[model samples]
Target: MSEEKYTLETVLSVKRWAANLFSFTMTRPSAFRFTAGQFARIGIQVEGELIVRAYSIVSSPFDETLEFFSIVVPEGAFTSQLQYLKPGDQIYLEKIPYGFLTLARYQEPAPHDLWLLATGTGLAPFISMLQDFETWQKYRHIVLAYSVRTQQELAYVDRINEIQNIFGENGAEFCFLPIITRDPFAKLNHRLPKLIESGDLEQEADLKFNVESSHVMLCGNPQMVEDTKEALKCRGLIMNRRGVGNIAVENYW
Candidate 1:
């Protein structure tokens, strides 16, 4: 790897949400630029080798520092070291950002409602998108459905609530649905694809999904993305291609 392609950044802080889930903020290089829904290639040194991985940006594009949400996979090469990150620790960031999941990509048939479906750390990009002022101004209604294995894995609840409050006060219709699949006592206890298949998701949000007005963005586990895509397709929605269609997706892992 060329040194010119990446820059060294300092970790500003790290917050652990659970035994395996955490979020960290790092100093953003002065010239680093990225869209609201993009991922960054971050690296950490382990045993004299640089281990790198792609993590979706969790901070707003306008924010001075960059943030990311991560899950510590047991004995995983990159995350094992990443989970131990501390304030002032040095990490590596690629100079350029990459991703095609931004809302600006939806152009041909303009959408009126925006649906953000995510599971686990897949919620990272959507969080960044919601932080941007343009997201609230562009869509009349927005629904964010986040699913996790357990309640403990549902990260960023307070931050999501804060964003909802800030945008809702301005008349932007935003609904946040949290799904806990492992907890029987949770309000929404089914998987995302199943919820969509059963109409429970729409009923809970009080919003209908249609090809004409709904633009859906899916992220998180590959199975959830794939299954949800199939479920949405059954409802007449198509993947966004060449600036057209109703769905956009990214696989978190």
Candidate 2:
């Protein structure tokens, strides 16, 4: 890791979600430069040892500062320490933010929707982009699917709901759908592949997933990412590469 240090200039109120799950917002470092969907490696010094983990940026790039939404995984090496960090503490970070999920890689299909499929902390990047005005300027419509184990894990729902409620009347569209696997509150109780097959996904959002007209960005648990990609491929969508097509994905696990 590079020998760099960042000061936590401010620590917003710590908010709790479910049992043992909490999120904190920290002020961005002046040196951090990242796109809406990129991630940064962060760490803290513990007994002279460096403990770090990669985290997606939850705050929009257009904002003056950065923020991240994270879960406190008990006994998790890095998160354990991070949960205790206070305002003004020094946090280590690698200057570069890198990931494949950025909008620059996707080709806009004419008059189609941009689907951002995420689960758990994977929702981070989508939050960053949805808040970004550029995303609305690029895609005619945007659909964000956030999957979690339970309804309580559906953090940031209020803000996302507000975003949709505020801008939904315009030409651009926003839909926030929460998927709870272990609870009855899920809009689509099954995973993405099942939802795609049964038409539940399209019916719920009033959109279709045609390869020629849709751009899919996948992020989340490795299993969910792989399954969603295979399903999309079966439906004729190709993975996005610099020289190829536009089905981008990132593994949050």
Candidate 3:
């Protein structure tokens, strides 16, 4: 890691959570530049020491400013005070954004369908990807499946719904499927691998999974990612590495 420049920017908004709190878009310095789906190390200069953590870039890369999605770990040394940030308060950000979650690293030449599976705050990177025009240009159909434990855990609800409506009626082929495992009111009820194995996802969504034509991206709890990877392997999907093809994973617990 190179020496990064950090700055204090205003806190745009505060989002409350069961255990953690999320802060929305904040101001960015003129020199900050990064692609969507990347992450930056953030810190706060407080109490004669620096408390910092890494967070994913949740906003579209085309945006003029910066945006990040984060969780306030209860009793956490760094996040305890971060959760109380005011609108004009300053937050720290690393000068450089870095991560392998960007689409530029996908090995496939061309894929028919792009499947982005996420759980909890793991959906941040996918949020960045779904909003980018480049994603639409790469794949004909995009299926983003997100699963959360409870309804309150669901974030970015309105914006994702808006994106669904905007793309559904238009020529763009994109679908957003929100799955709540604990809420029976949700459209789907189960983890992604179980849904994939039982055929419920395909039947309900009217989409078929073809290894030859589909590319899968997984981000979430390590268990979900590992299990889903195994399930896909049983279906003839292999990991997409620098030289391989089809599946890519960013397991962040």
Local distance difference test scores for all models? 0.93, 0.77, 0.77
In model 3, pairs of residues that clash are 9-91
Ranking by TM-score: 1, 2, 3
lDDT of 1 by residue, 1-253 (tens): 6799899999999999999999999999989999999999999889999888999999999999999999999889999888899999999999999999999899956858999999999999999999988899888899999999998898999999999888666755999999999999999999999999999999999999999889999998999999999999999999999999999999977
lDDT of 2 by residue, 53-106 (tens): 888888877676667777777878877777776655666666678786888776
lDDT of 3 by residue, 1-253 (tens): 2244776677776556555647477887778888777887787767968777878878777776667666666778877777777677777787888888777776664657888889888888888887777777777888888888888778888878776665455434877788999988788979988988888877765777776777788887899999988888878888888945777888665
Top TM-score hit: 1
Q: Per-residue error at 174 for model 3, in Å? A: 1.5
TM-score per candidate, chains pooled: 0.98, 0.90, 0.89
Identify the runs in model 1 with alpha carbons over 4 angstroms from their true place: none
For all predictions, the C-alpha RMSD in Å is 0.9, 2.2, 2.4
| Count of clashes, each model | 0, 0, 1
Off by over 4 Å in 3: 1-4, 17-21, 165-171
Q: What value of lDDT does candidate 1 attain over all alpha carbons?
A: 0.93
